[model samples]
Target: MDTVKIRNKDMLWDIAADLHFPPGFDSKKKHPAIISVHPIGSCKEQTSGNVYGEALAKAGFVVLVFDASFQGASGGEPRFIEDPAQRVEDIRRVTDYLVTLPYVDEARIGTIGVCGGGTYAINAAMTERRIKAVVSITGVNFGRLSREAFSGYNPLGALEAMAQQRTSEARGGEVRVDNYLPCSVEAGRKAGLTDIDVLEATDYYRSPRGEKPHGATSGLFSHRAAAIGWDAFYLAEVLLTQPLLVVIGDKPGGFGAYRDGQEIYGRAASKQKELVVVEGASHYDLYDKPEPVAEALEKVVPFFTKHL
Candidate 1:
């Protein structure tokens, strides 16, 4: 568990990461590596990014769990912004750093993304062939998820608001940010957010389960402007050529919960792609729960071993 700083090729943000090495790791020998990416509005310390990084390290792969630039310990301005282009580039840049290491097998690298990170991972793999395998746990495309979740009800209205907000900001208004989840369980229930996924997300992110002070609860309005119009599913139909594994939950009554993973798995052009729905588990269950996390790693660890 060593903390390291990686500078992006653009020389703008200094990405902060935690590098994990397998027990008795020898720097003299090259080993396969996994780059673990965190979800939107979150950092390296809050979710399954670091957890899977540790698990894969123990499974004998070198792993890096890094905070995306501008989100965590990494350096960037106007904090909590989610720039899709920058995020994808961040993964490629991380891979660039990995290949520079003498102990890393540049030809055998993989990536695991949780939540929105999954979409970024897919996008990165599409253009950067350095990533040999792709694994996503309970993943979702943040752009599509946000748009569809609010469609028909408030999609048009929200778009109008964002446009107005951007215009105001350009004319010199105070910067405004909004939370994607309620600040607490009680707040969520009060706001009529009854879906178990939302409730569990609020509990996990806002509560002691996964909260970190440097990590933010809300995303910037500026960030939303960039994300709202983006679609991660773009170009996935043709350029995504790596072996892909998507692990999503299929709880008894959780119908729309796993649709994003299904869509991603469907669009991928990979000859070897699979969707493993974990029975009785909800989307948020895979974030931190031991049983589901273990089950997820059971599939992912081997996928990398076999492919990378």
Candidate 2:
């Protein structure tokens, strides 16, 4: 794996990514490529980005695992901003970078995203025809998830808080940010996040399991405005025309379940689409566990090979 810098087309940010070449690859030959996008608050090294990238590379496809534009090693100000629109643009920009390589097959490019990155990938596919195929693992339609899943998800209250924060910022008040995941295992448990998803997220992002210097699972509080207004399922019936493969855990309840998969599958206008729910796996299990990650890769590798 080699680290490389990709500049967003807007010339606004430099995306840091890990490029994995297929075993015995020939630089003179063009190869199909896959872009593996990490989850929200995740970097190129965390989640299953590297897992999938390495696996696909071994299968003879070039893979690029990257951090989002504003987070991780990517350059951006008002750090940790998780704007969905910009995230979608970031995926396209990465695709832009991929096509520039002489050894990359421009017509056979595909993409995969995990967690919130999954949603961003879907949104990117809506108009980015360069993405011939799309795959989402444990996908979260963050806009919908924020409003529907959590019991205490209050849009009005969040908007009110965002308004207050905006006013305070205008007055030169101190910048305030919030962690996307629990600060610690104890904090997650104390906040009634004993569920598998929360526990695993806390462990993966906060603990040594998958922590990175820039991946603190935190973002600007004002990001609430973008989070609250963004919709991942903006035009599924029309623009989401690419073949889609939604992979998730089978466990009931949570964004990684079959229900969320069905929601995306139902809305997509793709004539060819599939949903694979890994048996007995929970939302976060597919993030890193060997069994679940392997299970997802089993489906993903073939899907892209066939489509792209």
Q: How does model 2 fare in lDDT? A: 0.82
Stretches of candidate 2 exceeding 4 Å from the true structure:
148-151, 253-257
Task: Give model 1's TM-score versus the native structure.
Answer: 0.94
- Candidate 2 lDDT over 86-194, as tens digits, reads 8888888889999999999999999888888887888899999999999999888877766654314787787788789978988999888876677888987898875
Over 235-284, each residue of candidate 1 has an lDDT whose tens digit, in order, gives: 89999989999998886222243887888899999999989888778877
What clash count does candidate 2 reach? 0
lDDT of each: 0.82, 0.82
Lowest lDDT 10-mer window, candidate 2?
144-153
